[model samples]
Target: MRAVSLVPSLTEAIARSAPGAVAGATDWCTHPPDLDVVRVGGTKNPDTGRILSLAPDLVIANEEENRAPDLEALREAGAEVLVTEVRDVPQAFRELDRVLDACGVPSHPRWLDEAEDVWSSLPPPATRRTAVVPVWRRPWMVLGRDTFAGDVLARLGVGHVYATHPDRYPRIPLEELRAAAPDVVVLPDEPYRFTADDGPEAFRGLPCALVSGRHLTWYGPSLAEAPRVLGRALRAARP
Candidate 1:
């Protein structure tokens, strides 16, 4: 079955589970290092013409990562679109299973099993701390309300300071975020590519944990290592 995957995590899952099933993917679908599918476009702005030209049997997308108009256009053009909504770890596993089954993968992949095992193996948190997680700078967008990253951090005893905010991603001023006085400030390396030299300076007084964006945000093979990777980073964070 020929499939076009707009989400990078789903692309990797498909490629790893069913080697040659994917026909096209977005330019951002960078996993599987050797993936050679047709480049349709970006997640927010996929090239509809290129996607239709590929004539894929199915297309995979995420509710948050993809635009509704693009998905509608693909469906209007007679493409079978499968949209996934994963807000937490359990949801991610279930949705991955459903997507893989729809793609004709006979059994659960090793990575999925490993991811479940990794998360399950984690002991209860020894300490709990409120953290401010910044996904972007400049305009200063932060993780708020229900988010996959917030859930992941919560599992590791790190709760988001803005998790109760009305918006899923809220744009707040830097001064306001600092004034929130979180126990720690977590920064991921994507969307804004926050680095030690770049991001840590802003929160000089707070303990900063620089984490991998792929492990923190993506919901594919990275889930298997996220618990350990993020756990270590959070543990090592110092004021």
Candidate 2:
């Protein structure tokens, strides 16, 4: 079964589980490091013409990472598109299984099972700190309401202020976020590349935990190491 994955996480899972199954992948699908699929383009702006030329039987995408117009265009050209929505850990697990099955894999990849085991085995934290997790800056966008990253942090006993907000990823003014006065500002490496020197300097006094975007955001093999890796980062920045 030939597949084109627009989501990086799915691309990794598919490539890892059944090698050579992916005919094309977005430029951002960088997992497996040695993935040799045809580079279609970015997740948000994939080259639909390039994807179509690959003649994939199945095209996998995420509701959040991929745009609707591109999916529609693929559909209009008679390509079968499987769109997955993963708002939380449980949903992610289910979606991953569904995606693999659609790709003709007989069962869940070993890494997928390992990912679930690790999350279920996570110990409770000593304190559940309320944080403001920012995904982007320069007109800052934050994880607000029903985000997978928020749920991942929630599993780690980290509470975020925007979990109750109406919008999923609301763009709040810098002043408003400062007014929120969260215990720490959690920054992920992707979506913005929040490094120790770059992101922390912005919030003069507040503590910032520079977390891995792949572990925090992507829902695939990285799920296995997220608890340990993210826990360490959060612990190092503990107030």
Candidate 3:
């Protein structure tokens, strides 16, 4: 079964599980580094014509990562599109099973089991830390209420300052974020690519944890490593 994936995590999941089943993927689908698939474009603005040209039996997409118009266009063009909505770890696991099964994967992938094991084995955080997680800079968008990343952090004892906000990804001024005075400033390296030299300066006196965005945000094989990778980073953060 030939598949084209618009979501990066789904692309990696499908590619790793079913091998040659994935015939195309978005340009941002970077995992499985040696993936040899046709580049369909980016998540928000995928090339509909290019995707249709691939002649895939299934197209995998995410509710958050993909645009509705693009998915509709694909369906209009006679492609079977499977859209996934993963708002938390358990949802991610369920969606993984759904997508892989739809793609005709013979058995459960080892990584999926490992991811579940990793999260389930973790003990509750001894001390909860209030954190301001910045997903982008410039205009400063943060992880707000009902975000998958916020839920992931909450499971690890890190709570977002804006978790009660209405927007999923709210853009607020940097000064406003600092005024919240979080226990730690968590910075992920995607969407904004915040590095030690870049993001820390914005939260001078606050403890800053530079984290892997893939581990924190992407739901795939990275889930198995997220607990360890994010835990170490969060532990090392000091004011």
lDDT ranking, high to low: 1, 3, 2
Query: What's each prediction's clash count?
Result: 0, 0, 0
What local lDDT does model 1 show for residue 32? 93
**lDDT tens readout by residue for model 3, 52-157:** 9989899999988898998998999899999999898889999999999999998889998999999998898999989999999878999998888998999999
lDDT of 3 at 101: 98
The 10-residue segment of model 3 with minimum total lDDT is: 7-16
Ranking by TM-score: 3, 1, 2
TM-score of each: 0.98, 0.97, 0.98
Error of 2 at 80 (Å): 0.4
| Native-referenced Cα lDDT, model 3 | 0.92
The residue pairs found clashing in candidate 3 are none
lDDT of each: 0.94, 0.91, 0.92
Q: Pick the candidate with the highest lDDT.
A: 1
Give model 1 RMSD, 1 decimal.
0.9
Cα lDDT of model 1 by residue, 123-199, tens digit: 99989999999999999999999999999999999999999999999999999999999999999998789998988
TM-score of 2: 0.97
Q: CA shift at 160, candidate 2, in angstroms? A: 0.5
- Cα RMSD for predicted model 2: 1.2
